[model samples]
Each structure stands twice: as C-alpha cells, then as structure tokens.
Target: MKIEKRWIISFLIISAAAIAGLFWPEAVETPEILSQFGKTEDIVPADVAWLLTASCLVLLMTPGLSFFYGGMVGKKNVISTMLQSFICLGVVTLLWVIVGFSLAFGDPIGFHIDGRFYSVVGNPFSFAFMDHVGVLPHLKMASTIPFMLFALFQMKFAIITPAIITGSFAERVRFISYLFFICLFTLLIYAPLCHSVWHPNGILGTYFGVKDFAGGTVVHMSAGFAALAGVLVLGKRKNSSHIPTNIPFVLLGTGMLWFGWFGFNAGSALAANGTAAMAFATTTTASAAAMLTWIFFERLNGRKVSALGACVGAVVGLVAITPAAGYVTVPQSIFFGFITAIVSNLVLNAKAMKKIDDTLDVFACHGVGGIMGMILTAIFAQGENASLLHGGWNVFAHHMMALLLVSAFTFFGSIILFRITNAIIPLRVSEASEQLGLDISQHDESLDPNRHVPMTILDLAK
Candidate 1:
C-alpha cells in the first residue's frame, strides 16, 4: 500500500496515542469490551466554541496567578512575582511551538508505559507527528480548533508551572537565575512529563493507568516539588518571622484568581456542556470548603486565620480539583479540597522542621493538593473503567504510588536544573539587590508616588 504523507502522519499519531496509561496507576482505557459509539460525521459548533473560549480562559490564568502570588509578597516584590508568570507565558509558548509539544507527543523518547515500547507503539523518529515538516497533526479531542490553538492551551500549562516555583525563592532570587531556571524547567522537567500523561504517545497509558481529568499530578504536584527544591537551593528570605509586607494585595490577588478559575476548570472539559458545568460546580464548592476549613484550622490551632490563609486555601482547592474535575462527584471534590487544605497548611506551618525555605508555601499548597487530586481520581473516576471502586478497591494504593513517582521525578529534575542554572549564573540576588527589592533592583522601578507623574485632569489637559 502506498502511504500518503497525511496518512503517514495520522497513522503515526494513532499508534502513539496512549501515554498516561503507564504510571497513571489506573488509566481508564474504555476497554474495547466496554462498548463505544462510532465517530459521528456531525460537526459540533458548541464544542468548538467552548474549546476556543477555554483556551483563552486558561491563558488568563497566568496573569491571575501573578496577581495572586504578588499579593502574598511584600509591596517591593509585586512586579517580580507577576513578571515570573508573564515570562513563563512567553518562553514556554515559544518552546512548545518549536519542540516541546513534539517531544512530548511525537515519540517514546526512551519513556515506556511498562518497560518497552510496543509494536503498535513507536519511537519519536518513527512517528509522523514527530516530523514537524509534515502536514499539521490533528487530535480527535480537539479537532475543532487549529492545532495551533490546542498547542497554545497546553502551553499555558507549561507557563504557569515555573511561575508556581516563584513562590519558593520569591524575595531573594536573581533575575538571571530565575530566567535560567524557568527555561530549563519547562523543557526538561515539564515537557517529557506532559508527554507521559497528556501526549497521545505516552507511558502513562502504556504502563500505569493514571487518570488526571486536568492536572492534579502534572501541573500541581510537579510544580510543588519544584517549589520545595527551589527553596532548599535558595534558603529562606532575609526576614522570616513577621508579616513581612502587604496583606491587602494578597486578598486582591486571591479574588482575581477565583474569578479566572471559572475558565480554568470549566474550560478543561474542552467543551461547554454537562461535564464542564459539573466541573464549574465542583470548583466553586471545593474552594468554599477549603477556605472555611482553613479558617477553622487557624482558629483552633493558631490565634486566628489571616488574609494569607484564606487566599492560600482558595488556591489549594483549585490545585486539588485540577486533576479530577471532570471525573469525580461534588461530594468527593469537597472531601478532596478539605483534606488538601488541612494537610498542606500543616506542612507549611511545620516550618523549621526541615531546613528548606519555601517563600510562599508552594509545596504545601500546590504540590500536596495536586497529589491529593491524583490519588482521589483513582478512587472517584465514575465513567469508563472508572476506578476499582466501581467494583473492587485494590487500585487506591497504586494511585498513591504513581503520584510519588511523578513527584520524585519532578523533584530530582528541579534540583539538577537548579544546580546547572546556578553554575551558569548565580541564582540569588546580591545582598544589596535583595535589600533594594526586585522591583527596583531588577526592573529599576517602584510603587512610590514621587517616582512617576500622576494622571490627573491637568496632565490630560497637557
């Protein structure tokens, strides 16, 4: 049979279409035996509109995260924190277009679902999707948009990841080190891992049966571990004890994050129908639960819950639900959010228990929450293969183990990259720079009223 180039690309994509089946610990294969409805030629405009909107929504989350993170830090560091998220959008978007997407979805790249690549499976060089010069590849899940838009949406995930790392080294990191870490982390740490879980040709499906409705494992846990590694490398901020800076900004950031998240979770459904509506419901419920949980814990354990606790609780809920948004019920989501709030908050407060100096509790919130989501997905996924809970419950432990492996992989990669970036350029600001604060030291600006002219009626008159 003579194979057209288009056919070759399509065939190659079809062969490599199941990466998350491996360490997924419990992938929902929709086993051939279970039954499936054949593809309909009917075009769905609603689905298309939903996906396009969702991509934009996910993109907005970067700035939303910036505001959230910036508010938590001192006034001196606001722009720096926001800049980290914004820069991630620029760099990772470029990288994904060039090679990150292909690296993840193209070939095995030495990763396997079990131990070896199967015949139906393939190597990067062997896959048509791997060849950037061929006709653009298409995914059934998102055929409505230009593949470019799909790539852009996924790129948002990569962008926000390193931004999560900013919380660990916020006050003291050098700009050069920050740039160094962000570039390398997106490529080495994030790319392959994304391939493992989301890439059509991934190990997650081939090896373990991990089920991440969104990014409980990849985005949250991975970034959380990176946060831990970052603080370990950078040490604590100069001032550790007090409120350190502004509390009002943190509240403002949290509000914006909550607003933008409607798009983040609902949009993940990649459609605007029932599942997306369900995700929207769970997202709101879990956030509310986590926030109240934090206040209760604070009142019981500490003197009172501060502005920081409320904001962080909201974030933890968001992180925990990311991986299981479409799969679990609201009751399960509430359980997931509440548990994550308690656990992550404790880890952060356990402070000084380990020498690592996380600047803003990234690991406690994002990392821990992500792990909790991934594990619960295995327990609560209700469709297709569902979890063993559909019948038996043996797979729960396997789910935890998978999260651990992914966390370990992300942590080690982060540490190695941190060391390499440190060697290339110092990873921290000079003591003088730290004293000056990143906005002034790195960007050479400030929030001071005297620094710039105010926009008054007289100024407009000019």
Candidate 2:
C-alpha cells in the first residue's frame, strides 16, 4: 500500500521540526529567550514536572472523546464521528501555536470606559508565532513551568471545546463546513472567552471579579451553549435513529476521559501543592457521586440503569465540579456532582419530551451541568472572602452576571458563526449523502464490508 501524500508530507514536516528543535534550538528561539531572562524569578522543579505531566494528560482527552462519540453513532457514521474529534488535535494545535494562544493570554488591547477596564481580548501580536513564549516562566500565569507549556496545556482545552460541540450535529454536518466552523469558533468564541475569564486583565475577572477555576465558564458553558445554537441552526438529523453501535467503545472512552480529567482539573492549579491535591480529590469524588446519582435517577424514572447513563452522569459530574475543583471541599464537590447529574438527567428527559433533536444531549449534559456548577461554585467557594456562604452575596452576584454574559455571548455568537460557515459551504450533506452514511458518502470508508448503501432517504421513507 502506498502512503497518502498528506501523510508523507505531515511526517516530513514533523521530522524536520523535531530535528531542528533538537539541534539548532534557536530555530524556535527557545534557548536565546531563556538566556535573556537568565536568573529570572523562582521556578520550582515539582511544579514544572507536574505541569508537564498534566499537559500530556489533557492532550489525551480528544481521542478519548472520539471513542465516546463514535460508539454512540451508527456504524456507518462511526468513523466520521470519531474523526470529527480526532481532527481537532491537528487543526486547533496549529491554530493555537500561530495565533490562538496569543489571542487568549497576550496583553490586553481594549481602552478604558467610565473608569472601568473593559478588555475585549488579548493582543495577538504579544505572543504571535510563539515569540516571547519560551522556557522562562510567564510569572503572571504559572510561575514554575515554561510559559510555552502553559500555552500547550491551555491549547488542549481549546481543542476539546469545539470537539464537544460536534456532538450536537454529528452525522448531519458537512465535514468541510464543520472544519471551518471550529476554526472560527476557536478564535471568535473560545479565545475571547478564555481571555475574559482567565486573563489577569480580563473584563470578567478584573472588573466583575468572577472566579472560574478551570473553564466551567469558558470551556463547558461556552461549548454547551454553542451546541444549543448548533442544533438549532443545523435542525435535526434526517432519518434519525439514535442507537449505540458499540457499548464497549463508550466504556473505554469514558475510562480515558476520567483518567485524563485529573490533569484537567488538578493541573489548573499550576502547582503541586495543597490546591492541586484538593482539586484531584474533588474531581474524583464528584465524578463518583454523579455516576451513582444518575443511575438512581434512571431507576426512579422506571428505566434500567445502564453503562451509557453512568458514563454520561460521570461526565456531567466532571463538568460541574470543574469550576469548583480548586475552590470547594470534597463534600461540596459531592453536592455539586449530585445536583448537576440530577438536573442534567431531568433536562435530557425534558428535551426528549419536547422533541428537540440535540443529538447526544450536549446541551442537557454540558450546558445545564456547567451552569449549575458555576452557581454552586459561587455558593460553596472556600476562601473567607471568596464565597457567598462565607462572605456575602456579592460573589454569588458576580457569578450570576458572568453566567448570563457567557451564555448570551456563546449562543448568539455561535449562531452568527453557523450562518457564516453555512454560507461558505452548505452546512448539511445532501439527502442522498445522509442516507449513504458519512463513512461512505464523505470519506469513502466503512466498517462493515457487506452493508449496502441506500440510494436516498426518499427511498427509505417509501
């Protein structure tokens, strides 16, 4: 078999870059930058080690998501579904290195209005092409690890955010359109949101004092709401039949995601200290609690508890506790998990009753769960001056305002993006393609050799 041209080109490019990095070093400007910042502020070895480890862990989530999503779609669409998530590893990584990271973490560019610092986004030029992002600590972001590692860690989050939205439309989407939409969404939606919540001079954190420990607001909330916008724009999958093609695949994916999440939540602390320890503990406790709660809810609703339900509930728990991980105790995390799991289950049921085609219930699980987590984070926050329970309603009010802003921005912004992407390349495949399945229609690949491809949905309807 001959290697594909694209694969050969990719291999050569990566080989060249790796060799250059190893030998020249200055080609990437890493060594010179380190020398310029010689003897700069304290850098802890443990923190560096942990952060590097965490970044690797977070990078595993995309493929894990692939299996999780692929198993849910029919066999004909399985490859296409999985590829949607897997492709992000390449698309978003390049985008992040070139511009996405700078747009998120660079110095602010907005002007002051009425004595309030209103920052719209970071300056792309600040770290453009990875300039000024090297071995030295960024100090403001994470003090121990190389600044580049922080950007890489955050890139994993950026990559996975749009991947989450793919579940909303799944098999119906045109692959080219999906690609364009993710790139646009990363820059317009994910980057700006990341700057707003995580950047020191961001509008939400600097002016409104909102606390998002690890992307409950930026990652899950934005993706969830954006997913809501997606389903609305794409409408429903034609000839829709929701069934799991591989329960075992789903189980495997869930295992990988859960394993990776320790790094996702705990790694956000950016240190190997008490905060990281607490985040790790809470992450595990919340996931466990949510999984059990979801099964209990299923039983109460007169349905048999299932592995899929357990997987979804556990993911919901992870989403909910993300914001509260560094801020709340393990017990509060358990509460967060239980509450979000129950609420997501109810919302999923409601969506089914209302006949909304959310595909895999992205909105119900991530959107609703994230909002619940954000609210609970405000209430159960641990610091004496941070939490509504301990301090006052001010923190709670800030979180409430932040939630509204995020929800509106992601929903409306995503609608505009969807329309724009749809205009450039039609969002959905033709009726014939839909009937043929994306594996054969778009990719010309299929899992089953003997499976016949139908001519059209009209024929199936007849």
Top lDDT model: 2
lDDT of 1: 0.71
Identify the candidate with maximal TM-score: 2
lDDT of 1 at 95: 56
Put down candidate 2 lDDT per residue, 1-462, tens digits, no spaces: 555464566568667755654564233455644443433456788988998898888888889999999999887799999999999998898778777998998778776968867786989866766778777787678667778778888999999999999888888898878988998999999999999888888998777778888889899999999999999998887766767899889989999899999999999999999999999999999999999999999999999999999999999999999998999998889999998999999999984624758878899988998899899988888877687898858878888988898999999999999999998778888877787788888776789877665546423421
lDDT of 1 by residue, 1-462 (tens): 445464465456434443422222432434441122122333356866776777777777777778777777777777887788778876677556555665555545653335665221223332222232222224443544444455566767777788878888887887656876887887677777777777554566445667776777778888989988888887777764434366666777777667667767887776668999999888888888898898788899955877778888888888888888888889988987898888877887885634566777788888888877887788778865567667425456667667778988999889999999888778887766676668777776677746643334212221
Indicate the worst ten consecutive residues by lDDT in candidate 1: 126-135
Where does model 2 exceed 4 Å of error?
Answer: 1-41, 113-116, 351-354, 449-462
Model 1 off-target regions past 4 Å?
1-43, 111-141, 242-244, 353-355, 392-394, 449-462
The ten-residue window of minimal lDDT in model 2 covers: 453-462
